[model samples]
Target chain A: MAYWLQQILNALQLSSIYALIALGYTMVYGIINLINFAHGDVFMVGSFCCFMAAAFLGLSFLPALLLSMIGSAFLGVAIERLAYKPLRQAPRVSAIITALGVGIFIENFTLSLAPYPKVIPPLLKNITWALGGVTFSSLQLIIILLSIGLMFFLDYIVYRTPVGMAMRAISWDKTYVPLMGVPVDFIISITFALGAGLAGAAGTMYGLAYPVIDPYMGIMVGWKAFIAAVVGGIGNIRGAVIGSFILGTVEIMVVAFFPSTYRDFVAFTLLLLLIIIRPYGILGKPRTQKV
Target chain B: MNMHRDILLEVRDLQVSYGHIKAVKGVSFTVRRGEIVTLIGANGAGKSSILKAISGLIPYTGHILFNNQDLQKIPAHKIVDLGISQVPEGRGIFGNLTVQENLRLAAWQRGDKQEIATDYDRVYTTFPQLKERCHQLGETLSGGEQQMLAVGRALMSRAKLVLLDEPSMGLSPLLVREIFKVIAEINLNGATILLVEQNANMALRLASRAYVLETGSVIMSGGGKLLSDPRVRAAYLGA
Candidate 1:
C-alpha cells in the first residue's frame, strides 16, 4: 500500500509537468493549426535560461523562475517572427517543415553553447511532509500546486476574457475574424507568446524537481506532452489536462510494475490505439463538412 | 447623405481574371453617398467577383477609388479600416464565438467604449432573438439566426459603406424577406449599401439603381424599374 501511494504521488507530480507543457502545445494548435515543432526546444531553452539566471545573476529561485519564463517567451516570439511569420501564408507542409527546422536549430545551438549537461541546483529539495507514508518534497508540492493554478488561470482566460473569445473566433474562421475588424495576425502572435511563457514555467519547474538539465531535454518531454495533447483533444483545454494525467500515471505505473525499458513503447502504443479508435480524440468534436 | 460631394466609391475599367478565365472584365460602376445600389446577375455572371475585388480579397487590375483614394494597393483588413465591411456569402460568422463576442470582435478597431456599449445595445434591440442568444455560440444558432449575426457583426464595425454578397443565399423565403427588410432599415439608418444577388426580382425591388452582369461584364445599367424590361426579364428573370 505504501509503495502504491508513493507511485501515485510520483505519477501526479510528473503528470502536472506534462500538463503544463501540453497546454502550450494545445493552445497554439487550437488557433493556428500548426504543430509548432520548435515548442519543445523552447522548453529546453527555458531550463537553460533558469540555470543561467540562478548561477550567473545570483538570483533566488523565484526570481530565476520568473526571469526564465520571460526569457523563453521572448525567444518564442523571436522564433515566431523569424521562423513562422514569413511562412504564415505558405502551405501547411512548408510551415511544419520550418517549425521542425527551428526545433533542430535551437537544440544544436544549445548543444554548441552548453556542450555538457549540468545539474540543477537543489533549491527546494527539502522533504516537507509525508502523508500516508508517502514523502512529498517541497518542489513536488510547488510543482503540483503551480500546475493546477496555471491550468485554472488558463481556463478563466479562455472562457471569461474577450481576447479568449477573439482566439476562438479566429480559430473557427480566420477571414471572418478580420472582416470583424479583429487583427487576426496580432492575436495569433499573442497566443504563441502565451503558450511559450507557459512552456517556460513548466521547464523551470521540471529542472528543479529532476536536478538535471541538458540541451536535448525538451525532445522526449515535448513528444510526450504532444501525445497528451492529442489524447485529450488537441484544441480542448480540459482534454489536455486529462490526457496529461492519464499519460503520466500510466507511464509511472507501467515502469513501477513492469520493466522500465518498456515504458516508451507502452505509452506510444496506447496513444496509437487511442488515435485509431477515436481520431477526433477524447474531447474533440468531429469536424463537419459543408455540402 | 451628401449627394453633391465627390463619389464615395468608384470602379473604373475593373478586370479580374482567374487563371485563364476572366471572372470580371472591364467592369465599371460608381456608388454615391447614402444610395442603395444593387448588382443582379446569373450564377456565373461575376457579381461576387466584383465585390471580392473591391474588398481587396482578390487581385484585380482596376481603378477602385473610395472617397477619391485608390484601393487596389490596400489589403483586405486595411480595406475594412477604410470603412467598407463585407457580410460575405454563406453568412461567415465565427461559429465558435458567442454572439456578443462576435460583435465585440467586430468593434475591435474602435476605441470608443461608451459608443461600443451603446452600439451593442442597439444591435440587441435591432435583433431581439440575438439578444436572447447573446451568450450562445454562433454554431448553435439556426441559419436565420446566423444570418442576423453576420449582418449585426458588420454593423458593429461602424462602416460607412457595406458590401453585402448574396445575403439571401440559402435562407428560407420568409427569412430572405426579413433580411432584405433589415438591409433597407440599415440604409435608412445612414449607411451606403452595395448589394449583389442572383435574385434579380428581389434586387430590383430593393435597390434604386441596378446593374445587370452577364458572363463577366455589365450587359445593362439603368433605374431599378427599367430592370423589368423585356430583355432583362428574359435573360436574368427567366421570363
Candidate 2:
C-alpha cells in the first residue's frame, strides 16, 4: 500500500508538470486550431529563462518563476504575431510545417548558444517527509501544488473573466466575435501569452525536479504532454489535467511494475488504445461543427 | 434636403472583392437617423457585403461615414464602439458560451457599467425566454430563442444603428413575424436599422424605405410604394 502511495505521489509531481505543459497545447489549439508544434521548444525556452534567472541573476525560486513566465509570455506572443499570424489564413499544413520549422529553429538557436545540457541549481531547500513508509520531497509537494494551483488559475482566466469569455467566443466563431466588440487578434495573442506562460512555469518546475535540461529535452516531454492533451480532449481545459494525470500515473506505474525501459512504450500504447476507444478523447466532444 | 434627420451611415462607391470576384462593386447608400432601411435582394447581390464593409468586417476601398466620421482603416471591434451592431447571418451566437455570456459580450466595449445592467434588464424584459435560459449554453436554445438572443444582443450593446443580415432565415413563418415585430419594436426604441434580407415581402412590410440590390449594385430604391412596383414585383416580390 505504501509502495503504491509512493508511486502515486511521484505520479502527482510528474502529472502536474505534464498538466501545465498540456494546457498550452490545448489553449493554443482551442483558439487557433493549430498544434503549435513549436510549443515544446517554448517549454525549452522557458527552462532556459529559469536557468538564466537562477544561475546568473542569483534569483530565488519565486522571482525566477515569475521572470520565466513573463519571458515565455513575451516569446509566445512574438511567435504568434510573427510566425503564426501570417499563416492564419494559409493552409493548415503550412502552419504545421512552420511550427515544426520554428521548433527546429529554436532548438538550433539554443544549441548554438549552449551546446551542453545545464543542471538547475537548488533554489528550494531539500526537505523530506515520510508518512507511513511513503517518502516525498518538498520539491515534489511544491511542484504538485503550484502546478495544480496554476491550472486552476488558468481555468479561472479562461472561464470566469471577460477576456476569457472572448477567448471562448473566438473558439466558437472567430468571424462574428468582432461584431460584438471583440478584438479577435488581441484575444488570440492573450491566449498564446497565457499558454506559453504556463509552459514556462512547467519548465521552471520541471528543471527544479529533474535538475537537468537541454535544448532537445522539450521534444520528448512535449510529445508526451501533447498526447495527454489529446487524450484528455484537446480543446477542453479540465480534460488536459485529467489526461496528464492519467499519462503520468500510467508512466510511473509501468516503470514501477515493468521494465523501466518500457515506461514510454507502455504509456503510448495505452493512450493509443484509449484514443481508439474515445476518438474525441476522455472529455472532448466530437467536433460536429467547426467554425 | 428639407429633413431634420441626419445621415447616421453613408456608403459611397464601396467595393469589396473575394479574390477577383467583386462581391460588392461601387455600392452607395445612406441611412438617415431613425429609419428602418431595408436592403432587399437575392444571394450574391452584395447586400451582406455592404453590411460587412460598414461594420469593418471586410476590407473596402470606398468611404463609410458614421456620424460624419470616416470608417476608413477602422477595425471591426471599433465599429461596434461607433454604435453599430450587426446580428450577422447565421445568428453568430457562441454556442458553447452561456446565454448570459453571449449577452454580456455585446457590452464588451461599453464603459457605462451602471447602464449595462439596465440594458440586460431591457433585453430580459423583451425576451423573457432568454432570461429563463440565461444559464443554458446558447446552442441548446431553440432557433427562435437563438434569434431572440441575437436580436437581444443589439439592445445589450446600446447600439445606435443595428445592421441585421438575414435574421429571418431558417425560421418558421410564425417566428418570422414575431422576430419582425420585435425588430420593429427595437427600431421604435430609437436605434437606426439597416436590414438585409432575402425574404423581401417580410422585410418590405417592416421597412420604412427599401433598396433593391442586383449583381452588387443598387438597381432601384424608393419609399414603401416600391413594394408594389411592377418591376420589383416581377423580379423580387415574386407576385
Candidate 3:
C-alpha cells in the first residue's frame, strides 16, 4: 500500500507537467485545428526565461515564475501572428509544415544561444514529509497544487467568461463568428497566450523538480504532452488533464515492473492500441458534416 | 418609384466573383427604411451573394452604402456594429453552445447591460419556444425552433437592418408560415428586412417591394403586387 501511494504521488508530479503542456497542444488544436508543433519549444523557452530571471535578474522564485509565464505568453502570441496568421487560408499541409519549421527554428535558435545545459539553482529549500509511510517533497506538493489551481482557473476562463464564449464560438464556426462583432484574430491571440502561459508554468515546475534546463528538454516532454492531449481528445479540456495523469501513471508503473529501457516502448504501444480502439479519442465526439 | 423615400441600404453596380466565375455582376438595389425588401431567384442567381457582400462576408467591387457609409470600409464584424445583421443561409448557430449562449453571442458588440437584458426578454417573448429550450444545445432544437433562434439572435444584436438568407429553407410549410409571421412582426417593430428566398410566392406576399434576380443580375423589379404581372407569374409564380 505504501509503495502504491508513493507511485501515485510520483504519477501526480509527472502528470502536472504533462497536463500543462498538453493543454497548450489541445487549445491551439481546438481553436484553429493546427497542431502548433512549436508548442514544445515554447515550453523550452519558459524554463530558460525562468533561469535568466533568477540567475541574471536576481529575482525570487515567484517573480521569476510570473516573468517566465508572461514572457512565454507574448512569445506564443507573436508566433501565431507572425508565423501562423498568414497561413490561415493556406492548405492544411502548408500550415503543418510551417509549424514543424517553426519548432525546428526555435530549437536551433535556443541551441545556438546556450550550447550547454545549465543547472537551475535551488530556489525552494528541500523539505520532505512522510505521511502514513508515503514520502513526498515540498516541490511535488507545489507542482501538484499549482497545476490544479491553474487548471481550475483555465476552466473558469474557458467556460464562464465572455472571451471564453467567443473562443468556443470561433471553434464551432470561424467564418460566422466575426459577423457577431467578435474580433476573431484577437481572440485567437488570447487563446495562444493562455495555452503558452500554462506551458511556461509547467516548464518552471519541471526545472525546479529536475534542476536542469536545456533547449532540447521540451522535445521529448512536449511530445508526451501532445500524446496526452490526443489520448484525452484533442479539443476537450477535461480530457487533456485525465489523459496526462493516465500517461504519467502508466510510464511510472512500466519502469517499476519492467526494464527501465522499456518505458517508451510500452507507453507508445498503449497509445497506439488506444488509437486503434478509439480513433476519435476518449472524449472526442465524431463530427457530422453538414450539407 | 418614390426617389424621396428613406434609403437605408444602397448597392450600386456591385460585382462579386469566386475565382473567375462572377457571382454578382453589376447588380444594384435599394432597401428603404421601414419596408421588407426581398430578392427572389433561382439557385445560381446570386441572391445570397448580394447579402454576403452587404454584410462584408466576401470581397466585392463597386459600392454598398449602409446608412450612406461605404460598406467597403467595414469588416464583417464592424458590419454588425453598423446595425446590419445577416442570418446567413443554413441557420449558422453554434451547435455546441446552448440556445441562450447563441443569443448572447450575437450581442457581442453591445455594452449596455440593462438594454441587453431587455433584448433577451424581447427574444424570449417573440419566440416562446426558444425561451423553453434556452438551456438546450443549439443543434438539439427542431428545424422551426432553430430558425426562430437564428432570427432571435439577429434581433439580439439590435439590428436595424436584418438580412435573412432563406429563413424558410428546409422547413415544413406550417413552420415556414410561422417564420414569415415572425418576420412581419420583426419588421413592424421598426427593423428593416432584406429577405432572399427561392419561395417567390411566399416572399412576394410578405415583401413591400421585390427584385427578380436571374443569373447574377436584377432582371425585374416592382412592388409586392408584381405577383399579378404576367412576366412574374410566368417566370416565378409558375402560372
Q: Pick the DockQ winner.
A: 3
Ranking by TM-score: 3, 2, 1
Estimate every model's Cα lDDT from 0 to 1: 0.87, 0.92, 0.92
Q: What CAPRI class is candidate 2?
A: medium
**Candidate 1 has which clashing residue pairs, if any?**
none
Please write out the lDDT profile of model 1 over residues A1-291, one tens digit for every residue. Answer: 999989988999999989988988898888888898899889999898888887788777889888988998898888888988888789989999999999999999999999999877765546678877878778888889988988888888887777787888777767666676667777887788888888998999988887689989999999999999999999877899999999999899999999999999998898899989989889988877542
Select the stronger candidate by lDDT from 2 and 3: 2
Q: Rank all candidate structures by their lDDT, best first, as comma-separated numbers.
A: 2, 3, 1
Cα error, residue A203 of model 1, in Å, equals 1.0
Please state the i-RMS of candidate 2.
1.6
For residues B1-239, what per-residue lDDT tens digits would candidate 3 score against the true structure?
45544899999999999999999999999999999999999999999889989988899999999888898977899889999998989988888889998988899998888988899999999899988999999989987888999999999998999999999999999999999999999999999999999999999999999999999999999997789989888987889
- Tens digits of per-residue lDDT, candidate 2, A132-162, equal 9999999999998899889889999988988
lDDT of 2: 0.92
**Ten-residue stretch with the least lDDT total in model 2 chain A:** A282-291
Model 3 over residues A1-291: C-alpha lDDT tens digits? 998989989989999999999999998998999998899999999999888888889888899899999999999999999999999999988999999899999999999999999888887887999999999999899999999999999999998877888898888878889778888999999999999999999989899998788899999999999999999989888889988998999999988789989999999999989988988779987889664
| TM-score against truth, every candidate | 0.94, 0.98, 0.98
What's the residue-level lDDT of A148 in candidate 1? 93
C-alpha lDDT (0 to 100) for residue B172 of candidate 3: 97
Docking class of 1: medium
Residue A230: error of model 3 in Å? 0.8
